[model samples]
Target: MIEIVRTSDLVLLGFLQSLLENANIPFFVADLHMSALEGMIGAFPRRVLVPADHVTQARRLIDEAGLKAELLS
Candidate 1:
């Protein structure tokens, strides 16, 4: 998997997940369970990842959603 975006914004994370789901793109939210360890302080940002083959499409989708700034270069 390739990391596409890392964010502490739960709302944006949910929106991105939904966007990927609607487009039939498989994704995984890494470190999603870390909040328990970090006391839910948003200290550990979640990572959005996709298969190597899906990186381009996933990035394009995120970019179109006006989240280009969130994408990893």
Candidate 2:
């Protein structure tokens, strides 16, 4: 898997998830429950990951959606 977006925003995560789903791109969010362990202080930001085979297209879609800045370098 390739990490795409890493953020502490739950709303943004939900939006991104919907965006990827609508695009038919399979994805996983890592560290989703870490925030709870960290007392919801945003210390362990969640990560959005896509399969290695879908990385390029996923990145393109995210970029086209004006979320390029959210993607990992």
What is the Å distance of residue 18 in model 1 from its true position? 0.3
The prediction achieving the highest lDDT against the true structure is 1
Q: State the number of backbone clashes in model 2.
A: 0
Q: Residue 2 in candidate 2 has what lDDT?
A: 90
Residues forming the 10-long window of minimal summed lDDT in candidate 2? 35-44
lDDT of 2 by residue, 1-73 (tens): 9998999999989999998999999999999989768998998889999999999999998899899999898
What residue runs in model 1 are displaced by over 4 Å at the alpha carbon? none
lDDT of 1 by residue, 1-73 (tens): 9999999999999999999999999999999999999999999999999999999999999999999999999
Q: Superposing every Cα of model 2 onto the true structure, what RMSD results?
A: 0.8
Q: Candidate 1 overall Cα lDDT vs. reference?
A: 0.97
TM-score of decoy 2: 0.93
